[model samples]
Target: MTEPASARRITGAGIVLVFVYGVMALAATGRSFVQIVREFDDAPLAYGLSAAAAVVYILATLALMFSRSRAWYRIAWIAVIFELVGVLVVGTLSIVLPELFQHPTVWSLYGSGYVWIPLVLPFCGIWWLRTHRPAAVPELAAAAR
Candidate 1:
């Protein structure tokens, strides 16, 4: 008489959002890897921030794409919020202190390198999640019990 824990399904717009997240995750990870390996000394803060951004993107992608659980849903929200804050703070700092960053991070100037996707993605994520909520996985339901 109750909806199964695994009843969640990503439909319509949800699939597009997941694809975008996947792209962002790959882009950030690749960018950060290059920066860390090739020019870490040139811009430690930028490189470090890029790496951190990549990790957040990866987590977000995984949380949304793979899991259909209440916990992962919460994680998606947290990741999206953190990403928004990171972009805002880093974007401001990059503009205000141009000299502070020898190199730009993924969030620098609100993702200028990627056509502002970083700036826009979080808002989209929040909206999409709100509109297309997923059901919990069976494992998660059992754990929650």
Candidate 2:
């Protein structure tokens, strides 16, 4: 079935999200690698968390790019939600539990090092996915008709 212009536009948003998350994945991976190799003993937990965040970002980006199935939608939702919670929790804990995080993370200080883009991107992704959902489902029904 031919996709409506609206669906195309929404998919474009998802593509944009893929780019954004891909960049984030690169940044987080690079930073984590540097920290892990240069100073693993300094703050294993925080650096490890940074690596984990990078993996999640990569997975979410790929899922958004390659699949528009319900599974991908669910994955995107879960990933974005987890990312939001991760940032908030890690941001707060970094202050409240400074010893556990001797160094920074993508989420540390509410993503302060990254201008809080890390904190905001997930909300955008979720919104885009929600907006695009109807286009995906209805296209199938419209095809049958």
Cα lDDT computed for each candidate against the true fold: 0.87, 0.83
**Candidate 2 — which pairs collide?**
none
Best by lDDT: 1
The clash count of every prediction, one per candidate, is 0, 0
Q: For model 1, how does the per-residue alpha-carbon lDDT over 34-144 read when each residue is reduced to its tens digit?
A: 999998999999999999999999999888875466778889989999999999999999899989775989999989988999999999989977876665567878999
For model 2, residues 21-50, the per-residue Cα lDDT tens digits are 999989999999998999989888999999
Worst 10 residues of 2 by lDDT: 6-15
Off by over 4 Å in 1: 1-8, 135-145
Q: What's the residue-level lDDT of 68 in candidate 2? A: 60
